[model samples]
Target chain A: MVKKLPALVGLAVLLVLPQVLGAEYSWLVLLLNRALIFAIMAIGLNLLTGFAGQISIGHAAFMAVGAFTSYGLGKFVGIPFWGALPIAGLAAGLVGYALGFPALRLSGHYLAIATLGFGVAVPQVLNLWESLTGGWTGVKPAAPYLLGISFREDRPFYYLILIALFIMAGLAVNLIKSRTGRAFIALRDSEVAAQAMGISLTKYKTQAFALSAFYAGIGGSLYAHMINYISPHDFGSGISMELFTIICLGGLASVNGSIVGAIFMSFLPKLTERISLVIQKSGAFEHSHFLQNVFKNFNQVLTGIILILVVLYLPMGLVDLWRKTKNLFTAKGVK
Target chain B: MAILELKGVTVRFGGLVAVNALDLSVEQGSIHGLIGPNGAGKSTVFNVLSRYYDPAEGTATFEGKDLLGAQPHDVINRGIARTFQNVELFKGLSVMDNLMVGQHHNFRYGLLPALLSRILPSVKREEAEKRAKALEVLEFLGIAAYKDAFPAFLPYGIQKRVEFARALVSQPKLILLDEPAAGMNEQETHDLAQLIRIMRDKYKTTVLLVEHDMSLVMSICEHITVMEFGRKIADGTPAEVQNNPAVIKAYLGEEEEAANA
Candidate 1:
């Protein structure tokens, strides 16, 4: 019960926040929604990278597949937002499943390079195909609607992202506890042992890719609908790197860690911007715009510093830190 | 009757020839031992049986079925499970979870059922039952206290026993235990020998173990196969192999060669 109290409180806050806060905290609401969407993507990547021990730097490419699929299905095929979501996931999943073949042949840094090539290729493909994707300018998908509620604004749409997060989070939790989930961890620990235990490496690896893509696809669909625009510029290697970093920054092999990581990533820029505003007004670097630019890019620098610190001091990430703290307290009390 | 048979099995890594034209049989409900000196290809035989290394030539049959064609993953489904020379327990997972992985073949529920386990009572029941079965295996191995603890935290002897429980949880017809007593103390090795006998007596499961521990091998195993430089030097009962001049020369020759060099 103690373990579940925070999530229950969080759910209540999510349900009540938009109604109580009004327009003053509209940005907060939007940020939360975006964070939830990214959280969904991070959860998927955690399974592949943390549990399955496969490095994929092209995660955002799967999201791109999803976003464009939603656009194509919604705009060209006239599919409703509800209908387009699963279809978009399917499209991305199929592509991810195909990528698993190359993943099996390559590993470690070679796998990272292969996935980087894929990450770079997706946006190029989006830009090159002038007819389907609208080339450089990209496609502008309309705001999604369903059941008499227009999700043109951030408040109502927050519920959709929330619901998706809940379902996907539940699915991830369920998966990690099941036989297949055990197989994934086994694969990460020792492939030879896992194979000896009757886990098909090829089958599980592809399944991990497909499932990760499905989550990414759902997140992309939500993103496309929320942003009301689709452009190749919206996705790049940077976004994929962010997704990978979020999981690592939060915790590996942890569901709650992904959520925490997504929230941190989503709010980081705003936090930095606020700091920059304070720094600019304080007259610390009053003479030059170059110094102001430094403040503007402070988030990137801080992110790099944090990544280094996390790698050096907290290799298992924040989740392990939490466990250590809890263990310390419990041990003292018991003693 | 033999549960496993290897007829003229040969495995070569480049030109090294790890195992050469080996013929071996493991009888059902018997503790069989494969013993040899270093680089004698004892572990290589286990690898070939587990299908980790495909043999250059030969046929391996398990319970009258052609085992050579079976995929590595399918070895457990065909009622064969193996432990590694260096314990391959999932260090991240708890000891119980590692055993649960052994019961992979028993999980009949597909993706939907697993995902919706809370909503569906039957799936919940199956999951509970699986957990119970895993706990039972842990209790059987006398490692129930460490079930919730990660394998890395456990002592080396306990970790090896957990690996044994893991393979046993699958209820395999034949288990290939590779160097189970490698890092164990004398007491632990004696305990493992007794456990192997109990496993054979109570469960009637066949065991094919590869080890360099002569006392444990001679005490527990009804039959033994000795290898030297990728070839069978001797195959007989413990006393017979002890008396065999070829087996003595096989061990003495290696030490003498090392001394002379």
Candidate 2:
């Protein structure tokens, strides 16, 4: 009941959003749609870091694979956007599975560096292979198909994206409660220890990658649909770092933490721009060097500050805060 | 017939010799203990037997099957399981989840059924039965009470017991326990000794022990092997090994105590 009450309240908010804030905040809803796709990326990254203990700084590369694969399928094969989505995810998953081979031999920081290499290399492939990906211009959406129902408006696309996010979240919840999920956690906890317990390293490590890539690919696919166009610029190292920030601030190993992390990190830039505008109105400070710098690079500075503060103050992430608060109330006046 | 055999097992790391042509055997349904001084290769031998370390020169035959060049998982799948001296428990996993991972070898579902269970709500899966069996093993181990508790949060004794359960979950033909009684006080050691015997009598698991705990080793082991400088110095029934001169010198160090003492 305790858990359900909060979920019900959240559901109520989702149910009321289209009515209360839908008309005025259509752009806000669109931004949230972007956050949902990245939320999937954050959740996928969690499988690697939280469950497998494999630090991958190249997650955006996998997302890029998803995005580009979707585009490739549409352009060459004339597959509809929805038709290419799962196929694109599967292609990215195969790439993730192949990445797992190196993981069997290397570990810790070395694994991170190797994956970072993979991340750095993926965008270059997309750019150099301009025959398919159209060089820097990238590709735009060619409408969407769903069981013969065509989507031609922002409202249908928004609701469609919201459903995808919910489904992916549900999938994550299911996986975290299963055997492979536990194995991933066990592997992350200690590889030698996990092996002694009969958890095979190659199997679980590959599984983590395949799963993480799957979500990222699907997230990327859905994200391409919503954004209407994508290029190498969107799914670059910076975006990958943002995904990392989401997982780290949410908590490395918790399912719930991924969503919370996504919510906060996603809104941060918009919030910073709002602050920058406020600072702009106060013309008295425009000539000062510090104010000028803040105006120019306020988003990056705010993002860096938020990340450092979250790491310092809540290393366990927002999940721990929720747990602490719940404990406070549950144990109130008891002892 | 001897169920497990090690013929001329030698492990070399560049110039240094970790194990020098060690040879021994543990018969079916017998408790065998391998003991030595701190630097001796008793644990090294165990690692070689479990295929964690490739021997520089040796062939290990278990139940007439070749063990050389076998991967670690292959060794376990071939009915050999082992616990580490340092208690290698999956620290992030709960006591129950750890045991489930141990049962991974026998669970036959491939990636298709595995993913199917995740995607569709209405799909009936063979995955449930595998999870059910894992729970049964935990229930059998009496630490089922710690089912939801992570190994990191458990006490040393409980963690030790969890490792034991993990090793035994596969129902291996031979179980190699490295210092199973290490870091335990009297009561826990006593319980471990009793539990070791119970495991053999109940599960019919052939036992190979590597330990520094003399009292527990002497009590639970039927046959014992002593090693020093990577070679077997002595081997016999515990009664016979107790009086061996080489065993005394290697363990007691120029002292006069019997090997079995």
Candidate 3:
């Protein structure tokens, strides 16, 4: 119970955040909702690449499938957003399962390349199927409704996203602690040893892909509903790269790392904007258009530098850094 | 009765024949040893039994069931477990979790059940039982204290013991131990010999081990097979194998004609 206090408090803070922000800071609420969606995707991707040790560079394709499937179901079939969410997730899961067949034979950089190909190809496919997807023009999904309430406003929708994130993250934690999760880690450590212990690679690999994709799909559905509009470009290779970056920067194989990483990623651009504003106000580089351009793209440069530093020094990720610091303080106290 | 049989088993890696027309049998409830110089195909034979390598021409069976037809992962389910030539404990997992993975076959729950384990009573019960079983094995091996520690941080001897504990947790009928005493000190080797016997007596497990440590092998193995260049040169009791001229020649190299003079 003592160990769970921080998590409980964090959840409490999340619950009351929108109310605290009030109506004037509604934009921040929208940003937080986006962070929640990314958190959901990060959790799923972490399960695959972190615990299962299967690399997927095409995760956004799963998200795209979920987004488009939900949109199509809602607009043409007249299905409600809530009903389309699960179906969209399943559609993405099927695609992930199909992708797992190639994954079974590939590993390391080879798998990364295969997934990269997938990430690049999905948006093209979306663009080609113009009649169904509206091509490059994209589609605006209707606001979600349930019972008597319309989740059209950012505030109410934030709660919906939070609830979804809670359920998915909880399930991810459950899976990670179970036998299936052990099998994944087993195979990751040594295929020969894992197989000798009766862990079927074909079974677990495909299962990981399918499950990871399912989570990505749910996240995508939430993203589409929250943003109100999405095009193929929204789920492009860049988004896939960003999702990959989130896991690496946050920590691999850690659920908390995924959430923390997603939140950090969501707030990074805003943080950079604040930094640029401070610089401009100082009048140090007001006349330098070159410096202004550099600050404009500062988030990407910072993300790249942090990713390299993390990989070189903190391979276990930001979560491991937290653990190390706590251990350090405790050790000093004992001394 | 022969618990495992390899009839005319042969494994070839391109031009080199690893195990050539090797016929060997291990009896039920016996401590069997396979020993030879490096590259004599002792590990190859173990690999064949584990289904890591397919024999170009051979029929391998476990308790009269076709072993060769089974997949690598299926071998454990068919009551055969093995340790690697090098300790292959899952480094990222805790010692207890490594042993839990060894009991993968015992957990019958699927993905959905595992996901809902918190709410499902049956899943929770199964998890508890498996954890208890893992703890029991760890205690039996005297490594229960390190259950929560990762294998990478443990000493070499302890890591090997953890590997043994992992294989034993599955409760396999036949446990193939490849070079179990490879890097052990004299005292650890002695303890390992005792442990092998204990495993057989306590669990009714048949043991097949490959080792370069002659004293430990001669003391523990009830039956021995000596191979040279993938051919079985000698097979008998430890004393008989020690006396065989061919086995002596294989180990000592041809008695030099000049030395004989």
Using DockQ, give the best candidate's number: 3
Which should have the higher TM-score, number 1 or number 3?
3
What digit string (tens of lDDT, one per residue) describes model 2 on residues B38-125?
8788888887876678998888898998987677667778888888888878777777667777876776554444444566543234
Write the residue-wise lDDT of candidate 3 on B113-162 in tens digits: 88877888998898889889989988989999999999989999999999
The candidates score, on chain A by TM-score, as follows 0.92, 0.91, 0.94
lDDT (0-100) at residue A121 of candidate 2?
85
lDDT-better candidate, 2 vs 3: 3
Q: Is the docking of candidate 2 incorrect, acceptable, medium or high quality?
A: acceptable
**Residues forming the 10-long window of minimal summed lDDT in candidate 2 chain B:** B119-128
Per-residue accuracy of model 1 over A126-224 as CA lDDT, tens digit each: 888777678888888788877788999998898888889989999999888887788889999999999999999999998888889888988888899
Could you give the candidate ranking by DockQ, starting with the highest?
Answer: 3, 1, 2
Instruction: For candidate 1, give the DockQ.
Output: 0.74
Between candidates 1 and 2, the DockQ winner: 1
Write down the RMSD of all candidates, one decimal each. 2.6, 3.0, 1.8
* Collision pairs in model 1: none
Q: Give Cα distance to truth, residue B150, candidate 2, Å.
A: 1.5
